[model samples]
Target: MKTSKIIIYDEPTVPEIQIKKLEKFLHDTFHADTEIRKNFFENREDEIFQEIATTRVFELKKPFSKHIPTKLEIQIEKENIDNSQNEEKILYDGFEFQKIISKFIPSNENDQEILNIIFTNKLTCTFDESDFRYHARALIGTNPAIISTTGIIEAPAKPKEYYLDLMVNFTKESAEKIKEKYKGEFLEYNDSRITEVVEGYLLQAVMYYETGEAFCEDRECRLYNAHWQKELLYTQSNKKLCKNHEESLRKIINHS
Candidate 1:
């Protein structure tokens, strides 16, 4: 409730996002001004894309090292910025990508009370020093929070048996059959259930902005950091916050 307004930048490639519905969701939840915009990466200069391309993560286990992008890579960046749907599965260092994006935000609008949440099809990942590896993150919290639709699908692990089956029978056809066998057990590309899953992430972003806390330990909470596909669906099944978070949200709104 500390936020006076939320400006959401859409990811046009993913039509399942349905920006208008998400806008309504935020307005209804917080009684705050909600506005939707086109993808933030659109219409950016070539140099900006070059800078963003430099944030690409190559060695997943190693820490970030600034990448010197190839001409082809830069061209791909431009195409992606133009809202082309032919995006390759490129990995980007999420925090470094966020810093690049922050530079493009209008200086006047860069204030604490206006939450800028960006939605993207790109996979946003962070290198964990403790684990010494990269991990996909659905929501990177803060003023300009990023919700990666790809991350939502890819970050959470699928059922163990599915992986075990694929590990043994590893042809493309077999893999496709394995995925088909576990179809409804996890989120897939172009899944309609993304709308509900995304709502949870948006809630997490707002909660983080308001309280400086982005997650709940309870699997029943929408703010719970889900590591598995089953957990993600279970947490989002009812689309309700846990009792304590609900109370905190009420207090914030009331005080506002």
Candidate 2:
């Protein structure tokens, strides 16, 4: 493995992630020393909050033209309150947010071999020049990676029938009923299956940092890029990598 050690930062708001369990998962899977820390955003300088606020994406259809955030937005960033029940969804420019995080990392720990993975409730999206729009991403991989709990839930498409049923009569009461019909068909905010699903992302992040590839084309691989919730559920619950990835994993570990 390229990275000798991995340091994971916790996301306290979403306890379902089971970050501690994930720390163990990393050690067992990669044979790399894993360390867990408290929330990375806590006690950060005020300017960092201000900078983070600016990365918010207001227009999904447009390219990322840095948003000038309001005082309220900056305050909201500083507060970092639980957003589990938020009525309005907030999105951030993924790469820009990554840039801000890179700045906060200390020089000694900034090297390639000391990987840092940050878990956050924030939904991160990237602007696709080809599509000319932004799309939600669960993992933004690099030295200091971001694994978004919000993105894992919101990025993948829900059941087609569920959305189709929702479009027929979109009211609060009706939506509630529709959601009930497909309760177990897709992931909900507090789904117990979240921990297993997150393990897949952890694999992706570490592999991406070490191998320069974040995803696999194989459907059976945990590293497969899943666009739908069902695929995520199936691939993650299988709890096994494909033949090629398993081989690659071995080679990486052997070198380490």
Candidate 3:
């Protein structure tokens, strides 16, 4: 199997102060002992790169030639919430807990078979789709309940940062290589919390794909559309724009 380099870019448009604060928060929260670096353009003509964050390098194994593994199944055991008669505490208060529950290339209808390889902090040795199939069958044979979400909560709280974007650049071969190597065992062996990281990446990617824009300081702002008008008035903000400005901006955006 061949491996390829994948680069994921996160461009955030936050105020300088807020960006610094966020960087500090992430570093402290994750206990990541790395310094955040800013890239500035010297040319006065160019717009400054607002904010940039990169993911640690991930080497993916390819299982097939056409598609890359976009999702994974991992075991998530929630800590017991204290819902006693005296106390009703909400777990992870004020924090939206979103995760990439399961992601795969989806070779077949048997989504259940993929559950067997989902072990905690264990990375499976490299294998291909065929290997995943075999391992999945073995898992089903031993424990049939692995696929069922008996205690897992499907839809959890939404995160505070509702808008996100992700740009993943990788060759098809590299993605397949990653899947091939860790088909059934990727989540189990990897020590890092794969669920949260993957979810964040996916959220970013989806936001970028859907909106065709980057994150902004104003979380409420949507690219090329006036979010204020939409929220303030019950109409598409762009449509509600003043006739002259609307026509001029439309012409500029359309032509440019």
- lDDT tens digits by residue: candidate 2, 1-256: 7889999998878778788799999999999999999888888778888898889999999988888888898888877645652235689999999999999988999998899999888889999989899999999999799988889999999999999998898999999999999998788888889999999999999998888976999889899999999999999999889998999899999999
RMSD of each: 1.4, 1.2, 24.3
Candidate 1 error regions (>4 Å): 82-87
TM-scores of the candidates are 0.96, 0.97, 0.15
TM-score of candidate 2 relative to the true fold: 0.97
- Give the C-alpha miss distance for residue 130 in model 3, angstroms: 24
Q: Given candidate 1, what's the lDDT at residue 122? A: 74
RMSD of model 3, in Å?
24.3
Better of 1 and 2 by lDDT: 2
Residue 229 in model 2: lDDT = 97
Model 3, runs deviating above 4 Å:
1-13, 40-256
Worst 10 residues of 3 by lDDT: 48-57
TM-score of structure candidate 1: 0.96
Question: Which candidate leads the pack in lDDT?
Answer: 2
Q: Summarize candidate 1's per-residue lDDT along 28-143 as a digit string, tens digits.
A: 99889999999888877788889988999889999999999999888888877545232566889999988888888888878888889998777899999899999988888987
RMSD of 2: 1.2
lDDT of 3 at 74: 10
